[model samples]
Target: MMGFAVLLHVMAVVIWVGGMFFAYVVLRPVAAGQLEPPARLTLWAGVFGRFFPWVWACVGVVLATGLWMIFAVFGGMGGVGLYVHAMFGLGLLMMLIFFHVFFAPYGRLKRAVAAQDWQAGGKALAQIRMLVGINTLIGLLTIAVGAAGRYLVP
Candidate 1:
């Protein structure tokens, strides 16, 4: 059970963090270079609309498996080492940023897109990009902490 939970946790992080990297590093540049504003914005809206649901799933799995591992396998919060605790903290921070992005700017983006308010859509997209970038960095940091956490404990 613990091993399966760990697998789920790892997969969730991969999908969420890897997706962000693909978006930021690969897709964003190609889209910006190839597509005009209207097409680009539309593409982003559709992409995010599809992607956010997966992200939500990832968040759910991460939280569930993380808590399960900490408590069920590791004997609760007190037994978790500093590195795991740091990773947990970073993960929570990433989740909060994602929630803000989803509820706030993402809503605005969807509304602006629906209303054909290209300027507003563009503004909202920028905000989402900035927030995602922040989350991506945090996600990367969390991965690092998770990887090294076991060894770095003092």
Candidate 2:
């Protein structure tokens, strides 16, 4: 059970963080360089349309597995170490950010694309990009905390 939990945890992180990396580093630059504003924005909208569902899944898995590990294995929230608490806090924050990005800017981007309003789509895409960059940084930090937290735990 512990091993399964660990696998789920790692896979969740990988999917979430890896998706962010692909969006920010690879897709962003490639779309910017290769496509016109309309095409680029439309492509981004399509990309997020596909990717956000996976992020939602990953978020659910991460939260479920993390809470299960804390409650079932650690005996409850009070039993969790400070580092685990920190990781959970930041991870929850990340999830909230993702929720905002998905429901707000991402939705706007999709609408703009559907309407063929390239400028509005670009603006919405920018909003999503900024939020995603912030979330990516937080996700990376959470991974660091997870890896090193045990040593720092009291």
Candidate 3:
């Protein structure tokens, strides 16, 4: 049903985007201030290890629900509004960025933490911080677009 699909899609987006916001804004600052390299790095590595799985699952659910809504409820991509198209594009972009983060910097972060290589871990964390910050901003923008775009379009 449209209602169910919309609910799932929104919930998935909330989990992914809200998690990023919390990590980038709240956790990162407190962790950096309170913890030194080894502890900070360990915390992030552990945090990410736990969080990434949920994020990946959220990604799958969001994509599935979104497509279901578009094709089944809204009568395909052609029938959807520009807002839907924008949201779809932004969601795909976020997913691609997440894949890069998971494979590249996140991989290095895990390896560095395992090896107790603080320097490498720091570098990887910095990269992740930057990327996540960017993603968070973009996620917020996407939400705004999705929420308000219908009214704005005409």
Q: What does candidate 3's lDDT look like per residue over 67-139, in tens digits?
A: 9888888889899899989999998999999999999999999999999999999999999999999999989
lDDT of 1 by residue, 1-154 (tens): 9889999999999999999999988999899899887888889999999999999999999999999999889999999889988988899899999999999999998888888899999999999898988888888989989987788776
> Which residue ranges in model 3 land beyond 4 Å of their true spot?
none
Q: For model 1, where is the 10-residue window of minimal lDDT?
A: 145-154
Each model's lDDT comes to: 0.92, 0.91, 0.93
The reply for model 2, stretches above 4 Å from the true place, is none
State the displacement of the C-alpha of residue 61, model 1, in Å, after optimal TM-score superposition.
Answer: 0.4
RMSD of each: 0.8, 0.9, 0.8
State candidate 1's TM-score: 0.97
lDDT of 1 at 44: 94
Model 2 C-alpha lDDT per residue in residues 1-154, reported as the tens digit of each score: 9889989999989999999988998888888899998888878887887888899999999999999999899999899888999999999999999999988988889899999998888899889989999998999999999879989767
- Worst 10-residue lDDT window for candidate 2 reads 37-46
| TM-score list, all predictions | 0.97, 0.97, 0.97
